[model samples]
Target: MDEGANIPQYKLFINPFDLKELKRDIWIDDPIPAQLKVDGKRLEIDISYRGSHIRDFSKKSYQISFYKPNMFKGSKQIHLNAEYKDPSIIRNKLSFDFFSELGVLSPQSQHVLLTLNGKFEGVYLEIESVDQHFLKRRNLPTGSIFYAVDGDANFSLMSDLDKEIKKSLELGYERKFGPATEDFFLQEFIIKINTIPVPEFEKEIPKYVDVDKYLRWIAGIIFTANYDGFVHNYALYRNRETKLFEVIPWDYDATWGRDVNGKVMEANYVPIEGFNTLTARLLNVESFRRKYRNLLEDIMKKQFTLEFMIPRAEKLLQLIRPYVLQDPYKKQNIDQFDQELEVISNYIKERRNYLQRKLAKLN
Candidate 1:
């Protein structure tokens, strides 16, 4: 980790001293092993390994990202690829299977215990490293860590799309709501939400989840019952060599159902209120209503009725039952995760209509 540059420093995470101790004691039989620093000392976990490096501190999953040498730190970096692995925290294989089945493209991971330096400490989600060809074409410095780098595109959010999606028959990742970490405001918000216009083509007015690929994806998410997959979480990476864009889905920690005791519902998925300086302003409440009013109407109309969303959610929960029950320190609280999922799921399913109506009325 050559002391990453462009990497935003964040407030420290809740140190896992207690969890480390628990991991050390039980990791021999566990899938991933881990060791603890005495007294929660200043120790950083390297979240990279192999041809992959991790973007830690993001409001995303506990993951080690796989990438080619193009993104950053090609061949010389102390990434978490070799960090502490406590087999106990690794997601089961079924998680990957279910995600793939849902049309999401994520690296495959198998549970494995980690041995940090000489100590037993954590687990690893040994994933298949993604080819570097899939990222924005750039030769990153040994340690630059900026997100949203577009080395090849015109770099304008408005003009970067290929001719295919530019005609407006298909929508490619329109940023309706900026990340919660962004600073909020009316100008940026308007740009974020109302950027899309109704195409001149009346026959195909930018179908909501109506695009063939995304329609299948919507079906997949409804089937898998994991709504964590969003435009930001998904991307259409253009292969420089192939000159073609392919959509891939990422992040799945919110999969399976919310926990049984109901804590996960309140805790797992957060509303926009928790954001800091940058992301808080990204939600273009007014513009989102205007550009996506009709679509929101459709989702709201069918969001409920347990048949559409519940069965898939339940199926995912059943598949991950073993993993939810295996956390040594119970760091991945099953009940808490469950409650969060249910709350967010129901919100997206039901509240979407009212919210859409609000957006539709915006100036």
Candidate 2:
């Protein structure tokens, strides 16, 4: 919400064509090695598999694979974020550590300070790319779907795994994607979510410890109204010999109200193709309240408990602390994160009451 440029947030500006602007919308024309180009310098990548959610600027192709961040990592692909301003980079860098705290499986990450044109830019948490083999086991298609949505509200209308698997379903899911706001950041939203079906022909899915754990972590993510968790945001890993499965969380840029807002905005565009009105997708407060109560109990037992989340949160804060700047531009970014962290950490009891009150009235 704050809009002034500061030192840590903006060191140098990048051309859209520049390598650092690798946020997800661009396309690749060829099948060059899946390396990332940072500040015009190309780093060889471990995996050339193109991302299914975003285009390969070189290959113009989509694969459920990994592309390395085009920066310097020396031997490791994972890095924690340190400091700076770009909003796009800011969110994911924070997420890299946050999910780890929640015990969500994901690539190892490290912090990287990015500078464009010599100015102190924002921070980035460079992560190691996950393997593509996991997707194959899920019976997920190899190439990308023609049109996939990352955590789309429309997909919620379809039967989720809880129902198909016969697990007790939580009614707390939100519907903020309904007909409301016009000019939604649809393109950017794509990076974090995508929908694909489990292949019907593939029978008898393999058992993997991480899959179950990942699902619960994802539920915890949504329980807190964290919506950056789309199907694509998660990936599975399989041991070639054991055939075990693991799920890894990716792309936290859209979590924590990134995809939602209060009910007052006007809309010029309906979210989906056929819906005539926008009222259908508004967040249903009743469902959230019900679902949240159940999820909270579980968080205490599992994900966000003192044994699980606190250490990670403390570690994350420590990891992200140095990169957090007191500088002019970066301060706003840090402040935004700090404000959210406070809301979730210290003010939750009060905030929960307020949120419940608002939800009760809104519904």
Question: In TM-score terms, which candidate is top?
Answer: 2
Candidate closest to the true structure, highest lDDT: 2
Could you give candidate 1's per-residue lDDT for residues 1-363 as a string of tens digits?
111122221212323663364335331322222222323333333231121122222111232321222123232112132212211132223344544654544445444333334433223333443334223223411111112212111112333334232322122333222233322222232233334433422222222112333333333343223434433334443333332233444434343333212123322243212221111222233333233344334544554335555565556445434443543333355565455345546644443333434443434
| Candidate 2 per-residue C-alpha lDDT over 1-363 given as tens digits, one digit per residue, 9 for 90 to 100 | 222232122222334453333444354423233443344555444322244433322222122122444334333323223222223234454455556655655455445454534544444444554433223434443321111224232223333434432121111222121222211322212211222223311122223222345344444344334343443355433333443434456555443333322121112111111120111221122343344345445554565333443344455555544555533345555656555443334323432344444433333
User: Which runs of model 2 end up more than 4 angstroms from their true locations?
Assistant: 1-103, 132-211, 228-230, 242-246, 256-298, 301-329, 332-338, 346-363
Q: TM-scores for all candidates?
A: 0.37, 0.44
Q: Candidate 1 — what's its lDDT?
A: 0.33
The clash number for model 1 is: 54
Error of 2 at 184 (Å): 35
Off by more than 4 A, model 1: 1-95, 129-210, 225-228, 239-244, 259-262, 266-363
Root-mean-square deviation of candidate 1: 14.6
